[model samples]
Target: MRTLNNHKLKLGILDQSALMPGDTPTDAFRRTIELAKLGERWGYSRFWVSEHHDTPRLAGSSPEVLLGALGAHTSRIRIGSAGVLLPHYSPFKIAENFRVLEALYPGRIDLGIGRAPGGMPIASQALRYGRTKPSDEQLPDVLRDLGGFLADSLEPGHRFEGVRAAPFVETKPDIWLLGSSSFSAERASELGAAFSFAHFINGDGGHEAVKGYFDSYRPGPLGSEPRANVCVIAICADTDEEAERLALPVELALLLLEQGQFQRPFPTYEEALAYPYTEWDRMRIQVNRSRMLVGGPVSIREQMLNFAGDYGVEELIVVTFGADPAARLRSYELLAQTFELA
Candidate 1:
């Protein structure tokens, strides 16, 4: 059996600022900041926040804005978006946003962009409601424009060719393509951007998707070779039983979400325990369980490393959830301790 650590594997965190039970958005944001600060002190390599619009279940709608706060709290760890959904905004404008972030947190910024719409159809429509040209260009074109601006490699006579993203710093933010499929894998390789496979979203097919990325990578201005990571859901505790209990809420939450029954102010783990899941819900949880790694630190270590080995990647980005905020914080601490990350 492979120990799955021929070389040291780095770990990062993805915080969605999930709102639970009675917590306000302000409370959620504060917890997120606290997590970044603690994560840095615990030797985490990166701390990224996610974007979710018009969703009471998740308080973070703007990762770029949240990253600014994270930067203020942590001195060493890289802070970025788990990603910014680029489809709703302009490429040049998005470039400008990251440029400003890079200016503030210079060498510590990552521009992780995704092609997803980011929320429900109504919310997505609301976000782009006032756009004069909603379907101006495809995602690949927009990605190219953003990269061109970031690297100053715009082809001659291209639209917005000379329009620079200003306040440029000595080191620009690294661009990363976030997705869970081959489409993202190929595009990321073609553009020379770092790719982060969302194993938590799509557990299957990641091995092939990631293999395609590393096999067909074409180096560009962003990176000299392929750099890829996998993001997974984890809930670790002192005991396997405790970890499983802590993981209950997100399990139910995902099932409800997949079935179009998600509730606002997402249920806490304790509340979720009382939920009366039908047989179908139980079966769905069994399938969704494949996407999560829930156990004690030792068990979680093996599970995480297995996924890491499967994708042939060295870094794993973890997103943990629980009713107890303390357990959520401890989860990272335990993982770092088990891996001896320093």
Candidate 2:
């Protein structure tokens, strides 16, 4: 296994600020931008948003748009998707959007790719209309096509042969592979892309997957050495009780997802506090708590440092979820204090 080094832990924010129900896309975008601006002051290295279409709760369906907006507001913090689901969009289009952003931002953009559709079956179908659904078997080809577009490689006789992105961007946006399973680790390693492990997606068994990704990872085009980041659920507070209370928003969402009941992120912390759940919801909540890291600063730091020691993570992206935008922002502040991001 790899060991942690002295590279001042690269802290980042993974914003899904809309899950606080009734949160509008505009609100989510603004909140994320605010966080990015704050992160710049705190010395954070990056701020990543995700892409989820047709989801009432998630307003980050268009990550590129949000990233562009953030780039305009903040000068230093890195911005990108926790991942853009590659299976649903054309590689050329994805490259084009990112190319434009890179042109505007210079050295401040990243592009993380994931294989999941990131939404319901129907939503995925609608997004990929007329295009073949990508299977794990086809992931390599999809990645290759996207990679080719970025490198501006047009093989002879290919439909996009000799097609160069206009405006001639200066940056090759840093690309990261985001995944909840080991499947993507191999691909990231093979392609020399940085790998981001989603602990929030896989829950308690996340470290095993992270370890697997690093164990099998070999240097590729993104870097000669393997680079990996761990993304996890984190909500910090002055007191453990307060943190737990604030975590209710995410717990409510987990309960809903567990019961196959999906809704938009709530609008307020009080709104989530009123949600009704069954005994089964209680059971699932108990199970999911093991996957979350919520507590006071001391407790938060201890848990995270221990997890980092046990797993060789090169970067840590903290994700704060809740109904009230203020509460969500507080969670990030608390986490920043704990991680010394501030």
Candidate 3:
């Protein structure tokens, strides 16, 4: 296992393709593409995008489709899904989609799979076309099947054992189990797939979850060695106050999510900052903010390293997807500069 060093800590980006009031989905995607290019030039290790189906606030609906575009735009940085909602699609289809990407980019793709619907209940229904079974219940079996498809190692006599995910290439995308809970960590450990805990989504129990993963890791079809990272929401500015200011909108966004308004458009910077925070809202922000690393470059770098060290991982996929676009870009630039990634 590799020990994390602050000076050598690797950072990656997780973009949700969020949109403000005036921006169209196209504008958001273009920004995501440009962000990947900048991330590569800035020496970030991996650039991953998230999927949110038919959400007005976010544009990225299909990471595999988006990754194809991202793979063409950048050369050195690894491009990936943060991930794709695996339950809505077939493992064989996903295997073939990423196989096509691997054929194109050859060693620079990652396929992060999540069990969550990644959208509203109605949207999930539409996506499923009336499939009744719950995805969470079936995710483990799906993951195992996907591992076999990716490795061409389906057990003899099993259905689809000899079938190939077409356009097979020498390289394969890194398979990752992405989740915010111990269930995913345990599964990833059992299957030997890469694990990325969504710390931004669920802040508690992460250290325990990740520790369990490393301690109980076993070699499997997807990977022999344990690979892990934590995704964190961070906001960096020139000062602590500015960072807090930029975090307001995101805090409000999460608050809305908590209130069952998961897919509404993000509030504007002015709206969030100026909105009156009730006692409950303030308390929620306090809880949400505790998981975030928001400060200037120096403080952010220290907090990020401490986070990675606690999780026992060397890399942190940093998500600075604040409400401000220019500020978001500056956050990465400052982080790359502060960490000397470039």
Candidate 4:
């Protein structure tokens, strides 16, 4: 793998559009647009939103719709799905959806695709609506079809030959494969697409998965050189203590999620501070800490850079979660200044 000590790293933001108690979906969307605008001003490279289904705490179920809104509201920043769950939808439809966004926004669009169900099994079943589903092993074929539609390069004699995702615009959205495992890395490499390893979701596999991507990469339409990034949970505050305090709500929320308490919104810091915790809860938090980077500006900057170096990637996508929108916004601001973005 190639690593450069003096590489100028870029930063991107991933918004889950978390809906806390008393917050409506409308409020969540407004905040998403507001954050995208701020992210552009802060010089972040791209602003991506995630898709979640049947989750009351996450308001973003349709990233394509939100990407249209984001593109409309922000003039400079690149907007995309962090990504769209490919398994639940048709490849041609996904290509068409993003193609429309690309036609509307031209050069400022992206289409990050992933194989995850993006929700519980019941929700996944609902997404399929009783249709016979493709096996998990067929994800590669799905990706290939999606790429074919996007690139206008379906192979001769293919089943979907000549079925192009229209309006046939000159500019196509950049496509990336999102994953947290070696399977995704290998698939991305085999397909010659940009890869984003989800370190925030699975921290332990990143270094090895990234290495595997580099080793197996082949030149294709995305680019000859391997393009990859590591996505991680990050929070920054003026002081280390304050940063830890700010992280408490997300920590507790994740613990609850692990304990099968779905649909619960993030709690306030005060609530998290006062909540009684079991020894198991404390242990879960400690174990999950490895996946996050939480500290003051100095420490956060240092750790982010270290992660970039370790992963051999020059770009890092930061995903922040909090009950307070202001805290989440401030965390990105601090990171932007710390890295001197733009």
Worst 10 residues of 3 by lDDT: 131-140
- In the range 1-342, model 1's lDDT, one tens digit per residue, is 235672378899999998867889999999999998888888888998999887777899999888888898888999999798887888788888898889888899988988787777888878778774334236667787888888777889997777788876566788889998888888889878999999889878888889899899998755667899999998888899988888888898788788876455566876788989899989999999988988897898888888787778889999987767888888888988878776
Clashing pairs in 3: none
| Highest lDDT scorer | 4
TM-scores of the models, in the order given: 0.94, 0.90, 0.96, 0.96
Please give the distance, in angstroms, between residue 2's alpha carbon in candidate 2 and its true position after superposition.
Answer: 7.9
- lDDT accuracy of residue 225 in candidate 4: 64
Which residue pairs in candidate 1 collide?
Answer: none
Error of 1 at 32 (Å): 0.6
**Could you tally the backbone clashes for each prediction?**
0, 10, 0, 0
Per residue, candidate 2 scores C-alpha lDDT tens digits across 1-342 of 344433555678888646444545676667777888988887777999888877777778888888888898898888998789888888889888888988899888889998887888999889988788778888877776776677676556877788876557756788889888878887887777788888877765567767776677776545446778888888887899989888887777776776666664453557566767678878888888866889898888777776666667757888877666677677777676656665
The alpha-carbon deviation from the true structure for residue 165 of candidate 3, after best TM-score superposition, in angstroms, is 0.5
lDDT of 4 by residue, 14-63 (tens): 99888877989999989999999999999999999999999888999999
- For model 2 the local lDDT of residue 42 reads 73
Ranking the candidates on lDDT from highest down gives 4, 3, 1, 2
| Cand. 4 Cα-lDDT | 0.88
